[model samples]
Target chain A: DAGITQSPRHKVTETGTPVTLRCHQTENHRYMYWYRQDPGHGLRLIHYSYGVKDTDKGEVSDGYSVSRSKTEDFLLTLESATSSQTSVYFCAIRGLYGYTFGSGTRLTVV
Target chain B: GIQVEQSPPDLILQEGANSTLRCNFSDSVNNLQWFHQNPWGQLINLFYIPSGTKQNGRLSATTVATERYSLLYISSSQTTDSGVYFCAVPYQGGSEKLVFGKGTKLTVNP
Candidate 1:
């Protein structure tokens, strides 16, 4: 089992739909991040949470929102998903050595 | 905005070959990390070398904070090592946001 895991390993949703992706960590790391991976864009941060109830925007936070009601859970929600949002999303937590990532969630917005 | 550049966007090597991947940052950062994204799309933390050098098995990483560059070296590469290697640093000083480079794609053949 991974320390961090993302739900809905594969999702296909229609455009303009509201979708939520869950990231759960067994360890209570204070810092959590959501990033999307695309062909040419590499991995771009969508949002990051420094602490419970304290989240901030990243470079690519336009169509996404994040929440951390509890330390082990960081949620990423796409409001009115667009076709351009089709990408692989990864969740990670800052660890003593570095960031440990979860197996990505492949989301396709058709 | 700080710039993170990775060299040798693509690489190919025969089994047992050694390789070096480089990452250069435009400014200094408190945190620097190396990650490997496997063919299964699983992101694994390889190293967290802010400065100095660290080694693990056949892999090693060195970061020169003063020069704002890091290098990841892999020895005796195997076919299983074929994937993408990424280097990341804080988006800027005093921020927890991690910005990733475009990554270097590596292909190891038998």
Candidate 2:
């Protein structure tokens, strides 16, 4: 197991509310990624960080934002949650061999 | 951006049966990986086969970059392997961001 943990494993929020999911990794990986999985969409990247303070958006990054102030923590925030944003989010840390993912965070917006 | 395709959007097999999942990439990729999303929604890394073949327990994977496809083999499938299997590839010269296939949903019956 890669020492990866996702905070607030489950969350329920109302639409228009702000939600933040945190991913923490004990391994000093240089690459970190945030992805969301929805029915029929598989897993789509939202944002990723190559190093502290260096981040980039992905295909479905329209309503999402990410920040990495330290190597261990990567955060994903939804400025205003929407019904469409109700999905399972996963955080991953890149390794030389492969990537290790967190347990995932299930967020539901109503 | 590269395109990734996964075959057999859904699969059903008995506990002792064997199966194979495929992933096709539209372009050359520098990194290729396979992941298994368990029932709990945790994504676990299965293999990082950008080329050649590799095996771990009852799971094995082979990627032929020349052919632009990868295959994952599950031998003697167990009920525990009954989630979704995703294949992700990083485009060449990219920032190590992975483009994921829609994934194959596997249902194992005892």
Top candidate, metric DockQ: 1
TM-scores of all candidate predictions against the true structure: 0.97, 0.95
Off by over 4 Å in 2: none
Instruction: Count the clashes in each prediction.
Output: 0, 0
- Candidate No. with top lDDT: 1
lDDT of 1 by residue, A1-110 (tens): 35888899999999999999999999989999999999999999999999999999988999999999999999999999999999999999988878899998999999
What does the interface RMSD come to for each candidate? 0.6, 0.7
DockQ of each candidate, alpha-carbon based: 0.94, 0.89
* Per-residue lDDT of model 2, residues B3-91, tens digit only: 89999999999999999999999988777999998887878888998899999999999999999999999999999999999999985
Docking band of candidate 1 = high
Every candidate's lDDT: 0.94, 0.92
| Residue A66 of model 2, lDDT score | 92
Off by over 4 Å in 1: none
Q: What is the TM-score of chain B alone in each candidate?
A: 0.98, 0.96
Q: Give the TM-score (0 to 1) of chain B in model 2.
A: 0.96
CA lDDT for candidate 2? 0.92
